[model samples]
Target: MARERLEIEAPEVAVHLDAQDPESLRRLVLEACQRASTVRTDHEPLVDLALSQLVRGTPDDNLARKLEELAERTDDRYLTAQEAADPNWATLFRSARLASALSLALREQTRSSVLNSIYEAAHASPDTAAFYRDLLL
Candidate 1:
């Protein structure tokens, strides 16, 4: 079944998310977060939008690892988006990346409306959810 496109639009930006390939979907999520962050320095909204849309698309182990790696990079100032000419954009990227990593890690346990969409895609069961929950902490 084809996943429905989740359209996120702001005055200067419009992102369409419906890619079937996990890698493409991950790229799209990052692109969307980058674009949204450029428009607004605040990270939560953009990260939430990208992650919510990402869960609706597809899931891949490599993509999950990429998200985790992104989160880890935030600890290194030189490796983070913060070092870019546009420091605000880098901050946005770092924040969004962290949020994405958490979302992927707690995929089965998160209950937010956006996070729930990912559970649907994965069809995670109670045991799976419990496993994720155990890892929480």
Candidate 2:
């Protein structure tokens, strides 16, 4: 079966939940925090150093530093997006690169309606709306 899109509307101004609601907002936060706690940090420092060592470039030190920063950020970006969507690492990574391209336009925080702009730009994406599809779910 095909997976649905990752939806990102202007989240409701207020999504009402009753006191007894099991699916309340607090529950969702608790669940997310718990899941995040399980991802291992044991190899974190070594991974960081190894990754840093492998990411080198540019004629200037500043450019080299900037490139390295980008490399480091892109590393597990796919995995986080996968947390939003599918486990397919390939598709997720493609979406991550796409989102990075989208990130510049995203950085200008004006209204809360970034989703609409993202939706509009989806088609122009390097991966042809893959990240938008990923976000729509």
Candidate 3:
């Protein structure tokens, strides 16, 4: 038997990475965040596809840097567990947002707690609600 290793690359949603300006960077980052939850709706394959699109190619570096600069970053407990094993950077980011949205939506739906903080996001933001609705069921 022989042993082999492989290196994978990210996809290019757009053309050149650095050629993009600030606004484009913002859009890509937000797209990653929004896309972060949107694909979870269709189930696991879609989640994988979403991650493929999310971190595809060198764009993830730009997307991640933009996300860290403009928005909050997510951490994966599962990936953290896997850290001792596989230690995947991209997978960690991919899983975190999905977990965050699922947890938040579940808490909002199941519990009897703060109305404005949780409820407002569900009620006031049509896009947010639609995204979650589209993601969940």
Using lDDT, give the best candidate's number. Answer: 1
**What are the per-residue Cα lDDT tens digits for candidate 1 across 27-100?**
43333333323322233553455455555654444655554564455445434445566555444444444544
- How large is the C-alpha RMSD of every model relative to the true structure? 15.5, 14.2, 17.4
Range of the 10 consecutive residues with the lowest summed lDDT in candidate 3: 3-12
- Give the alpha-carbon lDDT of every model: 0.38, 0.33, 0.35
Q: Compared with the true structure, what per-residue lDDT tens digits does model 3 show for residues 45-66?
A: 5334434543432233333333
Q: What is the lDDT of residue 85 in candidate 1?
A: 60
Q: Which stretches of candidate 1 lie over 4 Å from their true place?
A: 1-56, 78-137
Clash count list over all predictions: 1, 7, 4
Supply the TM-score for candidate 2: 0.22
Off by over 4 Å in 3: 1-8, 11-15, 39-76, 79-93, 97-137
In model 2, residue pairs whose N, Cα or C atoms come closer than 3 Å (at least 3 residues apart or on different chains), thus clashing, are 5-136, 5-137, 6-135, 6-136, 6-137, 7-136, 7-137
TM-score of each: 0.29, 0.22, 0.27
Q: What does candidate 2's lDDT look like per residue over 35-97, in tens digits?
A: 222223333343243233322211133433443354346448656666767565444343333
Ranking, lDDT, top scorer first? 1, 3, 2
